[model samples]
Target: MERRKFLKDVLKAGVGVTAGLTVGSALSFASQGKIELPLPYVKLDPKKVADRAYDGYYEHECAYGVFNAVIGELQRKVGGPYLGIPTLMFWYGGGGAAGWGTLCGTLNAAGAIFNLTCKQKDFKAMIDTLYEWYQTTPLPTYIPCKGNWCKQPFPKGVSHSPLCHVSVQRWCKNASVYFGRPILYNSKERSERCARLSATVAAKVVEMLNDYHFGNFKPHKVKGSQKTKMDCRLCHEVTMKELS
Candidate 1:
């Protein structure tokens, strides 16, 4: 009788755990900026991660460049919940979130995946650095590396905004691709550029994750031309409201 009762209790505990995870995942999807609680994460190789981003971009033509790149590694290294997960849902992240042109799809994937493993305290700084990097750096640096699918040396441009339009416009300006001039910004080069950028972002996220794992993650202040006037107390106020 005691053995049967113990088995029943174990089954109940398993159900409870599954229910908790379901609730957490639902909340995660609903709350965009909120952090998801940390999950067990393996320290992925930064170089390999970047390569996957590059390859995946070319493979799927969207943030799948970032998603498929890392998902395979996650599946191979840490394969429990990630097993058999389909990329179909993530397809909408392309062309600025299903062609609406909002946030860069690469960054979107990076943020979504990053939050899954990063602790709450570390999420903001990592994302801030990534956005700053995207805005200020002349990108697609990985394209020049050997074995990259895109071989042309396109003009480099700095996008002051992380929005897709600004990034594409800057590329267009640099390449001199005007309104009836072959739309170089929308050509194959543009896809390659985004793929490379996705790789860069993926590698950096891996670096950050490793640092966090080792208790060495540090955030530097990012100061660019544009600054938003956000109140520091708002985060605490929001948390209080949520708790209430």
Candidate 2:
């Protein structure tokens, strides 16, 4: 059978047998049989990587105040997959409340990209690239309290919430394992390295989002009347102080 036909047959059979086999197990069986699997667009290569990352950067912090200014420019000029709920949720959950800080955002962003360029042959490369990217980017400034717009308020009547703290710690631990390296805390060298790494990844993601040929989805601008640009400086600075 042709490669595509063989893959289709395997997928159909996998679906039929799902009752008896876990998804991962079915996939593993398919893999051993030489059946191909789909992959996300951004995981395809360096170009796609740049595109997806860019989309994440543009949508950072749910900054709806400046959505019109940024979204149109990104769509028209950057010309990639418009940010969607899955992408936003990943960032908000992992980057915002999940407590991974910037590291989660970066990894989640990479995962989104991975979904795009995924192919059976590319799985190893995709996993490796994700780890490689994380090893270079490291962690960013973290705030334990909820004073900033990006974070949720501490649970009602509690001075401190162990759940929130635990969540962030878990994210960091997972990230370190994914990258196979110790997580880097904010420092002069590490900070600069993370900033540069983020920019590089963001640029790659944007390119992939555009190149994948996915239909355009309307950008969901954040709801607010504020007329200011949101930046890392505002969020990190204030939140760090609150945590301290």
Candidate 3:
């Protein structure tokens, strides 16, 4: 009995020591400020990223969901600097910045991902590409499987703008779903729609990141002119980059 107790204690001590060393190493790396400004990129599978974001939304809503989908994957794939990032901080970005309905939380998270991975000179272009694609594309295009939270097919719509207010309102209008108050927003369909949308956005971000890393990144070109609010042309339409 004495010898067995001694062995158990030794095993516990060994585990504690190993855990301490791992944590200590992480702390030391943070203190040294060695995490590079543009964090290293490794190609990621977009499908996997989408699945992660879909699940993440069930836990933390849009911004944190999309952010974790990418960063968490990085932490898993490349352990050094990524493990130090406090991903939970992004939880505040949900509901278009705490339900104020400003920039879409997914876009906010995607912008951050681009900033962290792309070069300084390329950042603006990458953002432009994403915004344009988002504005024009029919979102929530990723349909969840039969057993998933959203089993039925949901309506899709284009925001024509990046604001969450516009995006969600436009989508709700298309779906004929009312979602402003807490009760309305809490509906299963609404939650599922956002979850799938989060997945779609995360997948797009991963695709862009992979293309950028592979040196095949291209700014999406506007094929034809599209109309925005007539009065806001000076601010929105007259820009050199065309929107379609």
Best by lDDT: 3
**TM-score of every prediction relative to native:** 0.68, 0.31, 0.74
**Which of the two candidates, 1 or 2, achieves a greater lDDT against the reference?**
1
- Minimum summed lDDT over a 10-residue window in model 1 is located at 227-236
Error of 2 at 85 (Å): 5.6
Query: Which stretches of model 2 miss by more than 4 angstroms?
Result: 1-86, 93-97, 100-103, 136-196, 204-244
Candidate 2 lDDT over 128-190, as tens digits, reads 444443333333322222213225321111101112232244444554565567644432223
Off by over 4 Å in 1: 1-36, 144-151, 177-183, 220-244
Winning model by TM-score: 3
lDDT tens digits, residues 141-235, model 1?
66536664556555567877667766776777765642335546657657666777888777777777788786677755455324542222322
Ranking by lDDT: 3, 1, 2
- The better-scoring model by lDDT among 1 and 3 is 3
Q: How close is candidate 3 to the true structure, as a TM-score?
A: 0.74
Ranking by TM-score: 3, 1, 2
